[model samples]
Structures are given as structure tokens and as C-alpha cells.
Target: MRLLLISNSTMAGEEYLDYPKNNIKDFLGDKPVKALFIPYAGVTVSFDEYEAKVKAKFNEVGHDIVSIHHFEDPVKAVEEAEAIVVGGGSTWNMLHLVHKNNLTEAIRKRVISENVPYIGWSAGSNLACPTIKTTNDMPIIDPLGFDALNLIPFQINPHYLDKNPDGHGGETREDRINEFMVVNTDMYVAGLREGSMFLVENGKINLIGKLNCRIFKNNVQAYELSPKDDFNFLLK
Candidate 1:
């Protein structure tokens, strides 16, 4: 199983995917690959519009993508795909559609068995965990169940922030994650900061950006790990 799980798509003041275009290019390699894109998470935008936006960026990086919406049989599409790229939006909507289409197992089989490359950001990253219960998105829709792709053993709180905005007395991101830890005691959750990502290939994992990834567990105090640190333990 290979995954490039990004924290967020765009950085502040930058164009869409500009920060990770090179990373995506390098991951896909010099040989151009027309990846299969899953665009159901894009609720605010039409699937076609989302596809065009992402397609443009992939093309710029010497890779290409065709949205799965264009296919009649989504399962067959996943089976034939060389690569899978899931874009960020509403986690609920994304998983809802995945369940509705009965694609959960199909995708897992293809990526794990065939070693097909899988890339995702934001909500897409959330889908790679054992379950989507750690997602920060509102429950706009029932995802049928909380179970996700389970491509990775741990959960990822993408676009993770250290604190709440100015003047707000609401609970910080850490507080919420602490709440999750209270119940899912044995699981690991990585607070993946913006502009950073996790690269998991074979059985090894590595952090790919300059930002330090925050780690959280039930009883352990939360701490930061830089890109230089080994993240392989999270896989266990």
C-alpha cells in the first residue's frame, strides 16, 4: 500500500495545489499517469468543476487525472485505475458516496493488493484511517458507517491547528483530539499541520514537509515530531 496523505491542498496566499504540485509530480514519477480521481467530496462545487480544477494542476505536473464520476461502474473504475487521487471537501459526503457506490472494499483491494498509488488531502486523508470518527467536518450527512478505507492504522486530523482563533474561548484543536483519545485509547492520531504530509510506502512511513507533526495518544502527553523523526511506529 502506497499513500501520499496531505494535510491540506492550498497554503494561504498560494494557488490551488501549488505547494504540493511538485510533490505530486515526484510521487507519480516522470512517467505520466492518468490517475483515477474521486470527486464526490466536492459538495460546494460540481464534480465536473472540481475535476477540471484538479486536472489542470495534475497536467501542469506531468500527470493527469480522470474523475470517477465519468464512469458508469465505479467499482470497475477502481479496479482498472493505475492511481487514485481523492480531493478534499466534506468527509461525510465523501464517505457517504463511497458507501452508496459500494466502493469501500474495491478501493482497499486495489491499493493494498496491487500496490496502486493513492493520494489524498484533507477529508481525503481522513478516509485513509480506520474510521472517520476523528474528522473535523460537520456531520452534514450520514456516512452509512464510520469505517473508512483503513489503509493506515492511525487516524489523521488534517489541517490541524494548535489553537482556536483570536478572542474565541472555544476548545482548542488539542482539546477535541483529547476527547477522541478518551474513547479511542489505543489508536494514534497525528495532528497533521498545514503544508505538511505523510508518505507511507511498503511498510515504512515518513513525514514529507518542514512542519513538525503533532502526535497524540490516550495517556501520553502530546508532542511534536519533525520530518527527520521516524514515523514508522504509527503504522504499528
Candidate 2:
């Protein structure tokens, strides 16, 4: 299986996908690929608009994409897709539509079984985990089930932060994961901060970006790991 799970698409003041465009280009390689894009996570933006924004970035990097919405048979689209790309938005909406379309298994077969490259960011990244329970998105819509694609064994908390905004008394990100660990004791959760991502290929995983990813597991002290650190342990 091959996956590029990004924490977030854009930085505070950066252009949309500007930081990862080159990483995307390198991941897809020199040969231009017409990736099949899943834009179901989009809520406020129309599918066309979402596709256009992503297409512009891929086009800039010598690749292109076609939104899955244009297909008559979504399952068939996944089966024949050269590569799969999922954009950021509300994970709830994305999984809702994914279950609604009966695409959960189809996607798993293509990416996990068939080795097609899979790329996702934010909510999209959350869908790659065993369950969407770790997502930061509100339950604006029922995801049909908490279970997700399960492409990776562990959970990813995207846009993870060390501290809450000033004066905000809400639980820190770590506190929530601690709550999750109390019940799901064996699971691992990676606090993927902004500008960081994980690259999984051939069953090995690597962290990408300058920032250290905070690792959390029950009964173990949560700690930070730099990009140079071996992340393959997470796959175990």
C-alpha cells in the first residue's frame, strides 16, 4: 500500500496546497498521472470548485485529476483509477458520502490490494485510519459508522496543537487523545502538526517535515519525534 497522509492542505498564510505541491509532484513521479479525486468532504464548496482548485495545483506539478463525482459508477471509477486523491474538508460529510455510495470496500481494494497511490489531507487523512474517532471535525453529519478505511492501523490527529488558544479552557489535543487511549488502550495516535505528513509505502512509514510528530500510546509517555526518526514502528 502507498499513502501520503497530510496534516493540512494550506498553512496560515500560504496559498492552497502551495507547500506540498512539490512533494506531490515527487510522489507521483515524472510521468503525468490523471488521478481520480474524491471531493465528497467538501461542504461549502461545490465539487467543481474543489476539483478546479486541486486540479490547478496538480497541473502545476505535471499531473492532473478528475473528480469522482463525474463518474456514472463510482466503484468502477475506483477500480480503474491510476491513483486516488482525497482533499480536505469535513470528514463526517466525506465518510457519509463514501458509505452512501458504497465505496468503502472499493477504495480499500484498489489502494491496499492493488497498490494504487492514495493521497489525502485533513479529514481525508483521518479516513485512512482504523476509525474516524480521532478527527477534529464536528459531527455535523453521521458518518454511517465510526469505522474508516483502516488503511493504517493507528489514528491520526490532524492539525494537532500543543496548546489551546489563549483564554480557551477547552481540553488540550493531548487530553482528548488521552481520553481515547483510556478505552482503546492498544491503539497509537500520532499528533500530526501543521506542515507535516506521513508517507507509507510497502508497509514502511516515514515522517516528512521539519516539525516533530507527537506520539501517543496508553501507559507510555507521549513524546516528539523528528523527521529523521524511524516511524516504521507505528506500522507494527
lDDT of each candidate versus the true structure: 0.95, 0.95
Tens digit per residue, CA lDDT, model 2, 77-170: 9999999999999999999999999999999999988999999999989999999999998999998998999999999999999999999999
Local lDDT at 77 for model 1: 97
Candidate 1, residues 1-236, lDDT tens digits: the string is 88999999999999999999999999999999999999989999999999999999999988999999999999999999989999999999999999999999999998899899999999999999999988888999999999999999999999999989999998899999999999999999999999999999879999999899999999999999999998999998
Candidate 1's C-alpha runs over 4 A off are: none
Deviation from native of the Cα of residue 24 in model 2, angstroms? 0.6
- Residue 230 alpha-carbon offset, candidate 2, angstroms: 1.0
